[model samples]
Target chain A: MFLLQLRNELRKLFGKKRTYLGFGMFLLAQSAFILVLKYGRGPNQSMMRMMQGNGYAAAHFFSNLTVATTTLLATAYVLLPLYVSLVGGDLVAKEAEDGTLRMILSRPISRLRILLIKWLAGVVFSLILILAFAVFGACFSRLFFPEGGLFVSIPWDGVFGVFEGVEGWQRYAAAHLVLTLKACTIMSLAFMFSCFDIKPAAATIVAISLVFISKIMQDTPYFHDMQGWFFTYHMNVWVYFFAAPIPWWKVGESLSILAGFNLTFFLIGSTAFQIRDFKS
Target chain B: MISLRNVRKNFGGQRAVEDLDLQVPAGEIFGLLGHNGAGKSTAIGMMLGQVWPTAGEIRICGHDIISQRQAALRKVGAIFETPVFYDYLSGWRNLEILSHYSAPTSRHRIGEVVEWVGLTGREHSRVRTYSHGMRTRLALAQALLPQPELLILDEPGDGLDPEGIHEMRLTILRLHREMGLTILLSSHLLNEVQQLCTRIAVMKKGRKVFDGPLSAINKSQSWIRLRVNDFPSAVELLRRERLITDEREGSLIAVAPGSGTEHVVRCLVAQGISVYEIAPQEQTLEDSYLDLMKFDGPAPSGKQQLQPSVLATEH
Candidate 1:
């Protein structure tokens, strides 16, 4: 029964035209980047200079690893949340607004089961989006820049920190894999808001604003001590995979915190949803 | 079988449903009759576990809703107020989604049910394009998909055109008779209730004003109106005996109190007053409904329903 309901929910999510709009936007962005990276001399020259400074001998420094890392960072902050929340935030609130929640609740099943299926479906959609982003980044970037040794400087603390990497394709795949937790966390937050009696757009906007506020606080000097608790701090944890001698402890901490956030958001959502009367 | 015992629901100290107790046996089409704001919606919400009751226990087929809700809800199918659907999805998709939680209603069964509701070709269209009547029929189709033993609907014919209303009535009738499905109908339409329900429970201001078999409730309260000779003497004598409360157009209307209309006639003839004509002033279910709603209001009593008489100028 659970599988049946989850499948139905997946069908409903994918059936919407808006779901494809996100895919199209990401596809265009990735393809455009691929075109510029291959032919644009300014970006290529800058990469060549950075490679020389970082002690790399390769003429082209933008490999599959760098491209995947860049894409994960570039889109995960803004575009990913917007698209993910578009569906996640609408999971329950839209149903309530459409008055279908009352009709659906008329069945023999429990409210918790319905919410579980929806959340699971949202998680699945998030994974698909993350995987698609990875594939697009890898395929498009590799078309322009071959598989070369890669490196990127990180703001580990208050100074410039170079984390040189030559893990080849392994790091690229791991970077994408680690991002699922981040995507799930953001989508779950949006889904938690969706369980409320608010409008779908309002839920999505609030979820994005939460991330925005968290990101700002993470950058604020005074909030350095509190930054670890903010979700955005953990959301950017995928970058750890790009570092040479990958920070497994930091990555595990972020993964655990994200898992906790997902569980908490789900609990809050399901509990709130159970208490709702659908006032329709 | 269904039973609501001492059920009460209040919204912020304002009572929505008050001490509502009801019972509907198997194979009975129980009409929940009330005007708007009569707490019918709130009571139905409680029964469906959508609204939390301030106080009471509701049982369906002997399973209590407070603890054994799923067990109780399994046998029930319901449509509340307007039939709600996913406007973006096709009618087929809507049913397909609904069938997931319902008791394993198969795709083949869905096809049969869609045709059963007379929505064959239009199943591909989104529900946003469905008319009010079509939406209702679709709701019924999904509600019956589980083959539930009990079907509950609130104002099923609301907003339907006359023909649409007639069609909805026929659909409900067929579902009840052919399917032998127990039905609970909530509506302000008295005639619809009269035509459809065998038993009824009337709500007035969060309270059950009346609950019984329909025939019995209507039969107990009706008038026996008579047009007679000598209006002045007729009024004086009937008033003296307190048999008639008021008169109209040279006639005296006796409150039958249910049966024995002949006794009033005999009493009138004993006075040697010539009886010109005699007939029972038919009281419709509407009148009965009105009386239930106005039970506490200062309206004409059974006797006071009689208006002041006019003298027969022909004499």
Candidate 2:
């Protein structure tokens, strides 16, 4: 029964034009980034200089895997949260505003089940959005860059890694998989706000605003000691996949905290939705 | 099939439905009539489990709405106030989606219901392309999708042209007469209610001002209809004798309740005026509804009010 209803929910979700906005935006952004990397000399010079300073052959590191991984890092932080929040915020609030929630609730199904199904649908959408990002990155990179070794560096985090052969591609896939966790977390936050008596846009805006604020607080030197408490800090757990030997412990801790966050968001959202009156 | 006991709903400090105890028996078409904000929609909402009652219990088909809501709503289908749908989806898809919430309905059944509500050819069209009348029909189709034993419709004829209203009325009547389904319809369209419902309850403010069979409204007034050969002479005699207070058409007379039919007949015959027909004049539903709207006091507990009688006499 859950699967049946989830299918129905997915149909409703994908039937709307707004749900495809993320896919389109990612396609455009990835294509543009690849085009600039191919045509612009400044970015290549900076990359070559950074590689030389770190003592690696710059040409060997400028691979399809490197470009794709870099594209995910550059775009996932900003674009992923925005699009996931947009979809999650609309899952429930839009229906309420449109007056369709009343009719839907008029059925024999419990409100809790409906909320669960919708939340699960949002999670699925987040996963699909991340998958699309990965696919687009790989395709656009292959179109312009040659396949070679992988090089990744986040200077502020004091991380630089190099890998060749199957290990780099394996890490690349794992990174995209872990990136889904970040998308789901932001989506859940927006979904919680969506259950409240607010408009869809307001829900999305509030969710995105909270993410930005958390990110800023995490970056602040004053809150450096409490980094583990901020979701924005834990959201960077995917970046660890690019680390040498991989920090499994850090990944596990971040995953546990995010799983807890997801549960709490679902609980709060289901409760609010259960108690709300569909007076519209 | 439907019952409410002392149900009350308050939005903030404002009362939407107060002490509303109503029963709609099996296989009866019950009309819920009220003006705007009279809480007809609110009461229907409670019955549908859309609005939680501030006090009291509502049961549908012997299932308690609060504790056994799914069970209660299992046999009930409704369209409260406006019939809203997913405008992006086609009518067929909307019905297909809505029908999945209950027992799975087959595509053949969906097509049959589409034709039942006169949306056969247009079921493939997007709801946004549908007019108000088509939307109402689509709402009817979805409500019938569950093959509900009890159908609660709030203002089904609202925003429809006369022809559309007529079609909706016919569909409702067919559902009741053919399917033997119990119906609780809420509307301010008195004529439509009068034609479709066998029993009705009228709401005022947030309370039930009157409830009984359709015959009770007309019976509240003790009026006698009369026809005479000499219309003017009979009218003059009756007026002079102070028996008839109002005249109707060319010959009919509104005999006062104080004067018996015997006295009016005796006086008219004594004046050599031949009486053609004499019977109690039945009031229209409109007349009874207007009379109830003029009522100023709370309804008697657990009893249908006959206050409209006094108001009818005053009329």
- DockQ top scorer: 2
Candidate 1's C-alpha runs over 4 A off are A34-44, A156-166, B121-129, B224-241, B244-278, B297-315
As a TM-score, model 1 comes out at 0.87
When just chain B is superposed on the true chain B, each candidate scores a TM-score of 0.85, 0.81
Kindly report which residue pairs in candidate 1 clash with one another: none
User: lDDT tens string, model 2, A28-136?
Assistant: 8888877777788988678778877888887888878888888788888899899999999999999999888888888888888889889999999989988888888
| Complex DockQ per candidate | 0.53, 0.55
Model 1, range A11-99, lDDT digits (tens) per residue?
88888888777788887877776666567888767766766776766454566656555555666667887888888899999888878
RMSD of each: 5.3, 4.4
| Candidate 2 lDDT by residue in tens digits, B184-204 | 999888999999998888898
lDDT at residue B203 of model 2 (Cα atoms): 95
Q: Could you give candidate 1's per-residue lDDT for residues B1-315 as a string of tens digits?
A: 889989998888899888888888999899998888989888887778777788889988778876877898887888867888877889999898997786666889999999999999999999999999899989988898887899998888888888988998898899888989899999878888999998888888888877777876666454556777776887687667766644544553544233354666687799998877777666688866765664643222222332222111111
